[model samples]
Target: MVAQLETPILSSPCRVPYTVEGLLQVFTGSHRSFFTNVMAQALRIAGQGTPVLVVQFLKGGIGQGHEHPVRLGQNLDWIRCDLPRCIDTPQLDEAETKSLRDLWDYTKEVVKAGSYDLVVLDELSLAIKFGVISETEVLELLEQRPRHLDIILTGPEMPKAILDEADQITQIRRSHRP
Candidate 1:
């Protein structure tokens, strides 16, 4: 049976995450290889004992959704959508649309719970651009996120609003191999 998602309620103040200042960081580029660096960084952070959540907004085919998180070293939680293929365009069937929405809702719930010190939203911009996810809801999530939860958003065509709130923005460009 499919697990029903309950309405998210944010009232806990349990974790203070080992951080003084939680900053919004953005990494965007034309190359998908940039994700490798981010993953390495997430692993490093998790190794340091910080809880990290890495959500791949548009990636799937592994049959893993919010309920089945791949835990790496007890600190990092990696999750993706439950769709059969990666989302490339806006068009989606009813089932695919519901799956994507479930992931988003689950992500928001975990973020609200302060379950992770660092959260990575991978390929999120593409979801937003494709109209699978609303940019306004993302903004609301940012505004309501825990004070010490550092978030790193990775994808191309990031919205200006998100860029404006970013404490640091890294834009990658393709270049010939050295």
Candidate 2:
């Protein structure tokens, strides 16, 4: 269920400035998994005036020819950075590493151009864990983000420093195993 805030401002038509800090606090209070929906609602409401950046960190199965139904309904621009292709996996050889790094570098350059309203670094946590991308690079990107842009980071095991600096942090814990 979605937790409703009682603040009058929340009801107002004005765009609400949601930070990572506020979202973390809210998550601590309720165990509801409605953050994505809530965020979508908030963005829908806020989109009245300013553009909303809805960054999504997805694991595998992104470019497997199946279109994402949920993402299709959204109104913002969608830019996907295929994690497996962008990063060096354990199975990758030396030649693959160079190719992956090249891809990563190219993608980062595009991201640095600041064209999209929302930039989704899909499965970035795993990329960082696997040493495909550097945490410092992400920090720099966040620091240099455009003033009007809203950044969202998703994936498993986000770094503490990143979480602390984020305006919001939501941890999705699963019960059933694959």
lDDT (tens digit, per residue) of candidate 1 on 99-168? 9999999999999999988999999899899888899999999999997788999999899999999998
All candidates: TM-score = 0.87, 0.52
Tell me the deviation in Å of residue 25 in model 2: 13
Off by over 4 Å in 2: 1-89, 175-178
Tens digit of per-residue lDDT, candidate 2, span 59-142: 223542112213433444433333444433456556545544654565456456755444444455656677767889877867
Model 2 residue 110 distance off true place after TM-score fit, in angstroms:
3.1
**Alpha carbon lDDT of residue 106, candidate 1?**
95
In candidate 2, how many Å is residue 172 off?
1.2
